[model samples]
Structure formats: C-alpha cells, structure tokens
Target: GLSSCFHRSEGFMRGYPRVRGFYEVLSSCFHRSESPEGLEVYLHALQLLTTIHHGIQTLAVAGGTGQALWTFLCEVVCEDLCQPDDPPFVLQEQKGLLVHALAVLSVLYACQNQEAEHSEADTLLPLVGSMLRVLQYHREVSSGHGQKEKKEEEEEEKVDEQLQALIQTTVEFLSDIITHLTKDAVCELVTRGYLTEKTCLSAVGSLLPQFSPAVQHLVFMLSEADPQLADTVRKEFPVSLSPS
Candidate 1:
C-alpha cells in the first residue's frame, strides 16, 4: 500500500491528511512487551517510506517526527524484538519485524549524518546492543545450520530469505555505526552496559574480515579507555584484534 504512494507522487504521505499520526496509531497498539499479530505489516509499510528521498527527508527531520519515530523504534528494537535474553534461534521467529525495524532505523541514522546531528545515547546505544544481539544470534543460528546438506540448504532458501534480509539489515546498519564510531561512542556503549567481554567475542564472530578494521578500531579505543575489557576482547579474537 505505501509502496504504491512512492511511485505515484512526492510528498504523498506528508500531504495525505488521513495518514497523520499514523505511526502513533500503530505504535500505540503494539506494546513493547508484545508483538500483536499484524505488527510486521505496519512496520514493513513504515520501512517502505524510507525508500524514497522525500520519504527519508520526512521521517529524518530531527526535532519533529524523526525524533519521535527514532524513540519509538528504539524501544521496539531494544525492548520488543531480538532482546539479549532471547536465543539466537529466535531470529527466525522475528526476522520479518526485525528487518523492517532495522531498515527504517538505518536510513534515519544515515540522514542524521548529513545533518551532522548526533543521536542520543538513549536512542543509539541500546539499539547498538540490540543490533549486536541480532548479529550474534544470527551467527549462532547460522552455525547451527552448518550441518545442513546442500539439498537441505537449497530447500530452505524460501524460508531463509527473510532471515537473510535480517542479517543484511543488521550488518549494514552496524557497518554504518562502526564507520562513524568514536571514543565517546565506545565509552557510551561501555558505560551503558551494552558492550561487555562476552558480547565482544560473540558480536565479532560473524563480521570477521569485512568488519575487521572498524571492529579493531573499536577495541583499540576500548583499550585506551577500558583496558581490561579490551584485553578480554583481544584474548577472544586475537586475529581480529590486530592494530588498525
């Protein structure tokens, strides 16, 4: 439904009076502790809005709906889906919603970069924790599937598409965050209890090679600040811990 608007005209969503408070209406019904039956449909529609320039501009307008949307999404990701306490296999259960939520957040975050606006720790760090949790769990589930034969893997492709989307979404967003990481950002992750020694090992498992440099830089910053935590990470990932 929303995709139809994208091809039709610019500002269609913004100009549509009936669409006002659309997010609030949907969000109010989906509580943080619950995922009602059709939540993914709504989240997917919201995600469609991030696909076009005017749509991205509309949602990323900081100090307005962008800020509100960010807050609501952070809660959904950090609180509602793929929680640290959830098992990695849970990724299969939540992939559809996770992909949509992450896609929207990633676009909005990129928009903030153009404006040179920094996302608050509340909005960003917890989401980082959740995103890392997503990857770690995805890795766990993927490895769990390592025993699948070629035929089985091929047979599962239809079922695996949404899971693949979730992985791609989480990785892209994490890559963006890593690309723009800073000392203060690392500190916030630590201070907020988002990044710990166990998380350091697990989160880096799937992102090897491609994400090595940025992840190493992150650990190096950790060393400069929280040496003990850095030491734990270095011990766990000696290969990825090379000086960057």
Candidate 2:
C-alpha cells in the first residue's frame, strides 16, 4: 500500500507549488481527524514522504515547498504529542509519528542548506523548551515521587515503561539537532539565556544515565560545542562520555 502511494505521488517531487499542494492535502487530513486511525493515516503519509528524496527536500527542509507542514509540525504536532495524558496506546502511536517528524526536521536543519534564510537557532531554541518539558515529565513520572495509592503508582509505572522509548526517541532527536548546530548559532542560544545551566541539567544530567552510550555521546557533542555550557553539563551529569 505504501509502495502504491509512493508511485502515485511521484509528481509532487517536481517543484515547490506541487509540494505545497501535497502538504495542504495531508495536513488537512491530520487537522480534521479526531480518531487514532485517522491521525495515523496522515502521519503515515508524512512518514512515507521522508523516504523519498523529494519528499524530504521539498517538504521537510526550511524554505522548501512545505513550509506549512514544517511550521505545523513545530508549533502544534510536537506540542500535542508531548503531552503525558494521552491513552497509552495512543501515546505509543503518536511517538512513532513524532519521531518521524523530528527526523525530517533534524535532517533539514542539519543540512545547512542555503535555501533557508533563517538561522538554525531561530528555529531550534523554542523547541529546546518543549523537549525539556517532555524529558522532565518522563523522568519525574518514571521515578515515582508522590504516589499515595498502590493502584496509582502501578498505573504510573506502566505509563513510565510505555514512555521509555518515546523519551529515548525525543532525546536522540534533540541531540542530533543540537550536535548539528553551527558554532555561532549555539553561541547565540547560550548568550540569549534560552539555554541555561538549569535547563541543561534537567535535560542532560537527569537523563544521561538512562540513555544508551551512543545517545549520551551525541549529547556530549552538544556540550563540546560550547565550553561554558559543556562545563555545566559535565558537572551536572559527571559520567564518562568519550566519543567513539
């Protein structure tokens, strides 16, 4: 079925106007859907696009044909999917969709193409806060802080387990984006105070132990980009994270 869809949609690869039209159609499906099945189809469509060269270049990249989808993914899709209250099954499904979206955007930003006029920091700084919030929620819920009832604790534990992969995916996504940022962009992020030591500790320090070494290395690379912030991150996390 996916193969069939890809074959049929090849015309979308031609240029910006076609890409924008394609984006509008699928985004409409995503916006109109209230059911999980409905949401999944549109997400699947977006995922399918990532597999194609044009799908990514035309739709995912900044200043590409798919600015609408890019903005929607950043402003709404990610925010909604990061919520802790969704049903477990729904959350699991949303996790896959969000990861796909993140992959698209991360690749776009990392490429550093001249087509996009905006600085990577301009697009990425706001997302760091969203990413941190999701990570903090996962860390707090998984560790179990103030559960008075056994049932509630058990429920939280179950949600915590389901969320494990989601947390890892989110971390990997942010790590890739952070590691790819230009030196000047990272400096701007730090100088503006959008990325503080407290935020870094909350994201990197608290979650470092739980991450696989590869993901940890990626986060470590982010620290390496900024000496002062790196010192703060290293102090807070304090784990051996040598690059391979």
Candidate 3:
C-alpha cells in the first residue's frame, strides 16, 4: 500500500498541475504521521520529484499551490528539522531527516528562482537565517574538544561526521543560490545580524578544499568589496586563493 502510495504521488508529479496534487498528498502524509517514517517518506518523495524535469517544471509554476508548498517547507519542515540549540547527540540522531529536509529545500529554491518570483525571496530569507544558525551550532560542536571519556570521544566523532555532512550540504545549497545573490540580499542577511564570521567560515570549510574556482573568485571579489568582512572570515579559517 505504501509503495502504491508513492507510485501514485510520482504519477501525480509527472502530469499537468502536478505540484498541487503532490503537495496535497505530502501535506496529508505529514499530518497523519505518528512517527518519523511518514515524514521521512514525504521528504524522500519530495526529493525524488525534484530530480525530475517534469517535477521542476511543475514546481516552477507560480500559483496558490506552489506558494503553499514553499511556505510549508520553509516554515514547517525546516523549523522541525533544524534545531540549532539542540546538542550534538540530538542533532546526530536526526541528521538523516535534517539532510533530507535541506536537500529538498535546496531543490525547491532552485525551482522557485527559475520562476523568477521575487516575492519568494521574502519567504526564503528566514530559511537562510535558520540555516546559518544551524551551521554555527554544528561548527562549534564539531571543532575538537579538550578531554573526554572514551565513549564521549567516540560520540563526538559521530557528531562531527554528521555536522560535516550537513555543512557540505548547506554550502552546496548556498552555492546554488549565490549566482543571483543581489546587493539587497546581502544587506538583508547582514541586517538580520544572525550570521557571524564563524558561520561564514563554517559555510565555506567544506567548499574550499574542492578548489572551486567560481566560489574562490566570488569570495575574492566579496573580500575586495568588504575588507572588514574579509578580515572577519580570515581570522579563523584562511581560505587560500588559487591564482588561475
């Protein structure tokens, strides 16, 4: 029955006005969930559809259905998934859900941007703030500790691995949206004052070693534009710029 459910939703996503039906099904599934499994399946289905061309086209349509879906994702899904105040143990336990949620949101934002819906930017602003806060927490927890018992040390390692994975996912998500990052977007994020130098450094940690030229150039240009922000970013994590 569950397999049939997924198949039906998949088909719904492949046809006209697909997102509306898919979103309704996802909403219904999430509401009926008494356990994490329902939510997990919902996210899995969302992620799967996002990978399809038809799904992207479906999501790109700006309408009541699209708006509701995005709103629920930013408000409900992300809120429940990311708890910045949660300790490493809690976060480690929920890493799978968090990763899926972020990946889904990332794909949703990509589609939303394709539709050129500037109003959606307002909805996404808070999501970015939440992401930064979560990233900051993960960075703090993962940066090595002084002394602990053997079990504690092992647990810390597990947390570190999870946090690293999340950091990488968040970095890639931000990278996707960075191309259209306007001066206003930068100002809005800065004014929110939730983002700190540590957050920025953590955001880029997983991206630097790949030697992503576009990211490097973007950072270099940003540094030139805002030397103070550059100094703050470099204070802890010095990203070596490759000349090419």
Give the per-residue lDDT of model 3 (tens digit) for 1-244.
Answer: 5344435665654453456776787777767747677777676667666676666666667765556777877765446666555554445556666676777778767666544553355666677766665666566655643222346778768866766777777777766655455546655666666345666666666456663553555455446555577566556556544422
Candidate 2's displacement at residue 142, Å, is 1.7
**lDDT per residue, candidate 2, 15-47, as tens digits?**
324556656765676666475465555555666
Q: Candidate 2, clashing residue pairs?
A: none
The TM-score of predicted model 2 comes to 0.60
* Per-residue accuracy of model 1 over 1-244 as CA lDDT, tens digit each: 5578755776575675332265876677676436455677777777877776766777766666766677788888888776777766667667777888889888878886533444567677788888878776766666674233344676578658878888878877887786666778888888877787656677666566677776787777888768898888777776444557
Clashes of 1: 0
Specify the highest-TM-score model's number.
1
CA deviation > 4 Å runs, candidate 1: 1-5, 11-20, 32-35, 113-118, 145-155, 231-244
How much is 149 displaced in model 2, in angstroms? Answer: 9.8
**Candidate 3 residue pairs that clash:** none
Candidate 3 TM-score, true structure as reference: 0.70
Higher-lDDT candidate among 2 and 3? 3
> Among all windows of ten consecutive residues in candidate 1, which has the lowest summed lDDT?
145-154
- Model 2 RMSD vs true structure: 6.3
For candidate 3, the lDDT comes to: 0.62
Query: Candidate 2 regions off by >4 Å?
Result: 1-19, 29-37, 60-62, 77-97, 111-122, 145-165, 182-198, 205-232, 239-244
